[model samples]
Target: MSETATAEAAYYEHTLTHRPLDPVSRYTPHPGLAQITSKLLTLPAEIRARIYHHAFQGNRVAVTSVRGCYCGSVATGPYRDDLNWMLKLPRWGELSYEVRRAFIGEALWEIHCEKAFEAFVARFRYLSNGNDALLRQVRHIKVNVFEIIRESWLVETNVFGPALRSITFGPWQKGWTIDVPNAVESPDELSDEKLMVRVTHAINTKHGYGFLKEAWEKGRVQRGGWKALFLFPIRYHVKQKDGKKRWQMQTWRADLDEGVIEKDWKDVHLVQEATLD
Candidate 1:
């Protein structure tokens, strides 16, 4: 058959191997907890796939010319949360839209996404090993399930930038199993909280997360007092550039109001696809 079909079949075969058929019989064997978690994540995975399919299939401009690491149009519904978190990635920040798309590729990359889940599981295992004693006895960490939901859900946006030159779609390692250390206590230095903060800061600064200095500068000319009146929130603030500090966010509210951005601002971007439930 076609290469796409062959690839798709291989992907499914791999998934089945990881997640054995449920309701094990004499002929079937039970899978591990890690396998179970991997399957659970597939719910979101399928939802994300549909978004990509719709966008690429429709051949929408917003999907093709997006500025940042995101592919397809604005995500809607359940997929919004996943898209938001991706935008916040430090590696994504470093990548332009073209580079990001190349990394993700056009076809389904279940294996690549699986590797991310695997890494997350490994980290979770590390924490669980340390708190195993407390977790075994405790029933609940908090009361509000909604709060948990809110914390995990984040919104994302896609903006077009430079393209990537080379792409690697797999994890740093492949098919490696992590073993929790025998020590009863976990290292405080392995905290993910600090890792996330540092990653986010790096992305924001390195990728020009907040605003485009070049765009703002070009947008500010030939306006009388009108330009100054508009870009109030985005003043000529100093930001690091090329290992040295420089003026960024130079435009004001007035610059945006009657400034360089296309008149049909809404039409400039499009919502391509989304998933919520």
Candidate 2:
């Protein structure tokens, strides 16, 4: 090596011991090493994901978990010598879910199960699309479900009452690669009748026939918060399943209200995505 260049390199390496750490390493990074670190968040997510993908060759498992009791599953009829009854996901759980949904509709949410963890959920996690924003926010991980829809147009339909398309689940850390169905030109190509059957089946499977009927009656997330068993706000529409229902997205207006109000009800659990190879 050239003397001037070698001396300069030696001096730079010597000074490195005295220099303090870079400031961009806090909220995003764990310090100490000269090697690659978390502060790499400064780079674009796509780029970082590519780096991770290349380095790991996609072998790393993305895991998450959520804790909450399935409301209907809890014991009710029996009791100890004292004759105590049991209830779960009461006012506190209901109110907490509603408040979170009302204020941050897009944010990922989970109902904390108070029941025994053995039979009920403790957490949920899924593969991330390299969306660091959600990974940073989600505190828990792990999942499963009642219904699985294969409709193309359903992707564009509102999750609650035909108000929005592309429902959001977890900004899961190491997110599951979900295959969200594509929007088709004609929903008629898909069977509306069959979809209804699945809906009925999913409801029955998750909640009993009796609870299903009650949810059908209440029919609104805000009002039906009480009806939510494992989840919140069971809703049912009496009108015939409109196969031709015009699609709509969630919106808010303040024509008279002092603050922004929810124009459409949203369900966090009911909406989901799948991983297709």
Candidate 3:
């Protein structure tokens, strides 16, 4: 993508959306370093700034963890991955549509699971031609992945609903990708398992869902003396399923090392790692 276009779109999304830019490196870099140290030195400030700018340029939305839960399956439950389909949209318009449809299907799936303890979810279905007749019976859904630190995949979509063809849902097949400045968390800190749980609660509850949802509805980010960036509300569903329904928020399998390394909601234990290919 053109840097100019990226910057413009990013400016709109950041400034207009009041999305927070990732923090600058708190640790100052040495002005000059020996040849060997060069490899370890941070990128120049101007360059780093540009990199930060570009990282969140297009189709990049913030993610956070599930609220009020510890254990959820990482792969199937609530989690998120960067939308990698944006790059392909402008080139193959039809392909973009399909990707977006798939996205909606995934999102719808999450909505179903969030609203009820569903035993099964319909397959995220889409057609090569964006056919409404053929898609009449297909279901689409989405689950959000909330990013707290540098990491993502905390909240995820795991359910589906019937597909639609209007613009409201036309983009259903278009794909998505997230462009985060960096992985907020990394290297799995196992030494402080207890502390990690506390931290998780703080992020998932205090800053994750509550804030973003308001932001989306308000269409602007509110600033405050105590508030920081990347705070917003999360989407939740409270619908009927299998002729039975009750409110139960989805959970995630959080791993300190892998960052949602895996999830298993029924047990309510966010393990340290996930077992996925």
Q: If candidate 1 were superposed on the true structure by all CA atoms, what would the RMSD be?
A: 25.0
Which candidate ranks first by lDDT, i.e. highest?
A: 3
lDDT of each structure?
0.25, 0.26, 0.28
TM-score of each predicted structure versus truth: 0.16, 0.22, 0.19
Measured on C-alpha atoms, candidate 2 has an lDDT of 0.26
Q: Score candidate 3 by lDDT.
A: 0.28
What lDDT tens digits, residue by residue, belong to model 3 across residues 39-79?
32255656633432343222222121233222122322332
Which parts of model 3 are misplaced by more than 4 Å?
1-188, 191-199, 202-208, 211-277
Residue 105 in model 2: lDDT: 24
For model 1 the TM-score comes to 0.16
Worst 10 residues of 2 by lDDT: 77-86
- Top TM-score hit: 2
lDDT of 2 at 163: 25
